[model samples]
Target: MRLKVDFHDQTETLTPEQIVLIENLLNKAAEIEGIEEGSEVSVSFVNNDEIQEINREYRNIDKPTDVISFALNEQDEDELAVIGEGIPNLLGDIIISIPKTIEQADSYGHSFERELGFLAVHGILHLLGYDHMTEEDEKIMFSRQEEILAAYGLKR
Candidate 1:
């Protein structure tokens, strides 16, 4: 699968190495999840204030979140249709808060890279229709996240 990840670092906080790492991890994740060729996803890095504004506007939550995902293809059965055969699948956006990631890494006692990878994978999973709204779903989603992270050698 040719997974195209468009990264927008609004905060300009990610290094080249970090960008490469995220690219590799997200590609592996797309392959494992059977995303078709030319599938596209956008990842954006923002500050706490920007993310908090997004959170409040989108989720109606006032606090800044570490990561937030907007999936484009969560369609009901009746709404599903084949746009085209050769068209790229637009997965959606993964918005990450740089400051929140740093704080979470410190709080979780893990590397910033690890936390970043986790959030990226988590966002991708959401794009693939995974949710943790229930206990069983949480188990499935969290376990998959850990497994993917471990497979990519970003183990906690």
Candidate 2:
């Protein structure tokens, strides 16, 4: 899949190769999910301050999150039909807090690549209507995220 990826980082902590790795992860996910080859999605890497602002505005939360997904087809009843046909679904926009990602990665004792790949997959899963509001929901959501990451060779 073709992703119009835009990663804006104020700290410049991630290198060019890291961006390439992220791009690869996104493409692998799109392919696995059967999204169209030319489907477009945007990825934004930002500091905690920006993400906190977004969280406040969107979710009425004043805290910064690791990732947030804004999907255009959220309320579309035809989502299943659209995806089943393997059409160019405008998946959505994903915003990730870089500082949060690093913190989580360090806290989990995992490499930055693994953390980023996990977060990217998680955010896209949200765009695809996956959520963890309950124990069963968490299992399904997290399992799918891990499956996508492992499929792309991103293991923790």
Candidate 3:
């Protein structure tokens, strides 16, 4: 599959290698999810303050989250039936807080790369309609995340 990732770095915490790794991880995640070829995804890195503002404005949860995903192709069954095929889907955007990622990494006692990969995979799954709002959903989603991360050598 041809996955197009548009990366926007608003923070200086990510090195070039880290950025490349993230792109590769996103590509792999897309492949694992069976996303359509030529699909597009956007990733943005922001500070805690900026992410907190977004969380408050969009999610109404006034706290800084490690990552937030905005899926673009979400539609009801009726809308989906009317939608035409053969077009590349715009998956959505993922916004991550650099500081929060670092904090979580330290707290979880994992490398920065592993933590970042986990967050990115988590966000990508969200774009693919995976959620953790319930126990069963959380199990499926978290299992997929661990599978992808472990396959990528980002094991806990």
Candidate 2, residue 98: how far the Cα is off, in Å: 0.8
Error of 1 at 147 (Å): 0.7
Q: Each prediction's Cα lDDT score? A: 0.92, 0.85, 0.90
Model 3, position 73, has a per-residue lDDT of: 85
Writing each residue's lDDT as its tens digit, candidate 2 over 93-144 gives 8898889998999999999889999999998888888899999999999998
RMSD of each: 1.3, 3.4, 1.9
The estimated TM-scores of all candidates read: 0.95, 0.86, 0.92
The residue-by-residue lDDT of candidate 1 on 16-109, one tens digit each, is 9999999999998988888888999999999999999999999999999999999987787789665887777899999999999899999999
Candidate 3 lDDT tens digits, 128-155: 9899999999999999999888777778
Q: Show the lowest summed lDDT stretch of 10 residues, model 2.
A: 77-86
**Model 2 C-alpha lDDT versus the unseen true structure:** 0.85
On lDDT, who's better, 2 or 3?
Answer: 3
lDDT of 3 at 148: 89
C-alpha lDDT of residue 9 in model 2: 60
What's the count of clashing pairs in each model shown? Answer: 0, 0, 0
Better of 2 and 3 by TM-score: 3
